[model samples]
Target: MDVAIIGHSLLGGPDPAPAAPRADAVHNRRKILDAAARIVADEGPEALTMNAVARASGVGVGTVYRRFGDVAQLFAALLDERERQFQTAFMAGPPPLGPGAPPGERLRAFLHAMVDRVVEQRELLLAGESASPVGHYDHDAHLARHTHVTMLVRLLRPSADAALTAHLLLAPTAAGLITHLTLGRGRSPQQLKDGLDTLLDGVLSG
Candidate 1:
C-alpha cells in the first residue's frame, strides 16, 4: 500500500493552512448586509444604493460590488434574512399560526400573519418585485409558501383543489397588490387582515 503524505500527518493531511483571510471578507460582507437592511428599514428601499451602502458600511463602493454584486443582487440578499425569519415564524413558531392548531385555524392565522409580514416589509418587498417581477412567482420562497398552503388546504378538505386554492389564497398577499390596496387606495393593514379572514371563510367553507 502506498501512503501519500502531503504536509504533516501521514493521513492527517498537511498542517492547517493559514487561517483563511476570508474572515475579513465575511466581516465586511456582514457589515454591508446589515447596512443595507438598516437603510431599507430606516429610510425605505429607495434609500438602498451601492454608494449609500458603502458609506454606511464604511467600505469602499467597489467593495460593495465585490461583496454583493450589483443593486439587484443586493436586494435579493437583503430579502434572504427577512424571508428566513418570516418563514420560521409560521413554519415552526407556535400553535394557531404554526403547527399545533387545527388546520382551518392555522390557515387563518397564517394568512393574517402573512398580512402583517407584508406590512412589515412592504417597501423592501415592493422594490424586490419591481426589480424582478417575472421571477417572483418562481422564487423558491414563494414556492415554499405555496406548498405549505396547499398542504393546509388539503388537510382541511381532502377533495378540494388544494393546489389551485393555495395559489388563490396567496394572491392577495402579493406585495404589489397589498401596496396598491393600502398605499394607493388608503386602505389599512387591519383591513387587509379582515379581508383575508373573510377570504379564508369563503375558501375553507365551500
Candidate 2:
C-alpha cells in the first residue's frame, strides 16, 4: 500500500485539473450557439432544428448533434447562457441592480430588470414554460430570482413573511402573466415596469 501511494505521488497526484476545451471545440460551440440564438430569435423555437443550426453556423450537422445532443438541449443551452449574464448583472454588476443599493431600491431595480428580461426573451421563455409548466417555479433562474428577492424583502421588512413576499412579488413577472398582459391585453413593457414600481411601493412601505 505504501509503495502504491509513493508511485501515485510520482505520477502527479489526482489528475491535473480537467483540460480546458480544445480551441476548435470552443469556437465551434460559440458558432453553433450563435446560430441557434439567431434561428430562435428570427423564426422562433419551432424552426430550430439540428440541420438548421448547422446551416446557420456553417458547421456540419454531425458536429451540431455531437455538441448539443438534441434540439431541446440546444435551446436550453441558449437560455442558460442568457440566464448567466442576467444573474451576473444583478449579483455583481452596478448599484441599483447589483450591490450597494438599499434593499428597497435594489428590489425595485430587480423587478424592472425582470421586465426587460421578459421582453427580450418573451418567445423563448413562453416556449420553455409551455414545454415544462411545473418546472418554472423550480428552475435555476427562478430560484435565483426568488432567493435574491427574498433576501431583499427580509432586509426591508424584518417582520414580514419574506419567503411568501418574494413569491408574491415575482408572480406578476411570470411569463404567462406577462404575455397575457402585453400581448393579450395590449399592455406595453413600460406599463408593466410602472406597475411593478407601484406594486413595490406598497410592499416596501408596508
Candidate 3:
C-alpha cells in the first residue's frame, strides 16, 4: 500500500479543535491519563476502574467519567498515545526502524522493535486483544503496523501478497503469543527476535 494512502486511511481527518480547550481541562485530562497509566503499570488492567483512577488522580469521579467514558476508553486512550509514538518512530524517527535504511533491513528492524514493544506492554496489550479478538485487527495501531509491513514486504518481494504476508508476519507478534512465549515458555525478548530473524531469512530469500 502507498504510505500516503495508509496514513490518510489510518489517521482519518483531524477533528476540529473546540476553540482551545481550557487550561484547567487540559491539566485535569493529563492528570487523569497519567494516573490511570500508573495504576495499570503498578497493578494491572483489572485494577483500572473509574473510581480507582479518580482516587489516584485526586479528581472527582464525575470528572473522570466526563473525560473518559469508562475504563476501556481510558485504556484505549493510553494505547492510542503509545501507538502514535511507535508509528512516529518507525515511520520517520530514525534509520533501520524508519526511513533511512534499506527496505529489507527496515523489515527486520521493525519486527525486532515490535517484539520489544509487545514484551514491554504485554499485560495491557493482552487486555486490549482479549476485549475483542477479531476487532483488534481493525484498530489503528494494527492498521499502522500492517501498512508499514506491507510496504516493506512489497519492496523486499515485489510479487508477494504483501498485505496477506504482512498480516502473517504480524500474527506471531500478537500480545497473546508474546505473553505465552515470555510467561508460559520463559523465552527472552532476544530469543523472540532471533526467531523472527530466522523467519525473515527464509521469507526474504524466497
Candidate 4:
C-alpha cells in the first residue's frame, strides 16, 4: 500500500492560501465585531456600513473587509455570536436555572429570563431584524426560541405531545413577538409573565 502524505500547501489546491491572521489582525477582527454590535444597537441597522464599523473599531477599512468580506458577512457573524451568547446564558450561565433546578421550575425561569434579555437588549434585538434576507425577522433569534421551546418540553413533560407543545410555545415566545409585545407595545413584564403562566397552565393542566 502506497500512502501519499499531502503537504499542507498541496492539500486544497494551488489557489492562494489563506494567510494566517496576525495577532493584531485577530484583535482587529474582534474589535470590528464588537464595534459593529455597539453601533448597530446605538444607531440602527442602516448604520452598519463596513466603513462605519472600521471607523468605530479603529481598524482600517481593508482590515474590516479582510476579516468579514462584506457588510452582510459581518452582520451575519455578529448575530451568530450574539445568538451563541444567549444560548450559553440560558443553558450554562448563571441564570434562573443555574444548572441544577427542577425541570418544571427551570422552564418557568427560562421564560422569565428570556423576556428580560429581550427587553434589556431591545435595540440590539431590533438590529437583528436583518437576520433574514427579507429584513423582517431575526432567524438566529427564532432558532434560539425554538431551542427554548424544546427545552421547555423536555422539562415540562405533561404528555400533551411534547413536540407540538414546543411549537405552540415557540410561536408566542419568539424574540420578535416578545419584543413587539413588551418593548414596542408597552406590555408590562408582569403581564408577560402572567401570559406565560397561563400558557403553561393550559399545556400542563392535563
Candidate achieving the largest lDDT: 3
lDDT of 3 by residue, 67-174 (tens): 889887888888877777788789877888988899999999999999999887777788889998998798667887898899899898989999999999999899
The sequence of per-residue lDDT tens digits that candidate 4 reaches over residues 26-119 is 8887899889988877887788899999889999999789888998888777766666666666666564554566666667777777677767
Candidate 1 lDDT over 1-206, as tens digits, reads 00111123211235476667587898998899989988998998888899999999999999999877898788877786677666677777788877789989988888888888888888888887787797777776676678778889998889989999999999999999998998899999999889898888986788
Winner of 1 and 4 under lDDT: 1
Ranking by lDDT: 3, 2, 1, 4
Clashes of each: 0, 0, 0, 0
* Residues 1-206, model 2: lDDT tens digits: 11122112111243255689999999999999999888888998899999999999999999999988999889888887787778778888798998888889999999999888888888888888898898678776677778889889999999999999999999999888998999899999999999988889987888
Q: Largest TM-score belongs to which candidate? A: 3
Between candidates 3 and 4, the one scoring higher on lDDT is 3
RMSD of 3: 2.3
lDDT winner, 2 or 4: 2
Sorting all predicted structures by TM-score, with the top scorer first, yields 3, 2, 1, 4
- Report, for every candidate in turn, its global Cα lDDT versus the true structure: 0.81, 0.84, 0.85, 0.67
- Worst 10-residue lDDT window, candidate 2: 1-10
**In candidate 1, which residue ranges exceed 4 Å CA deviation?**
1-27, 42-46
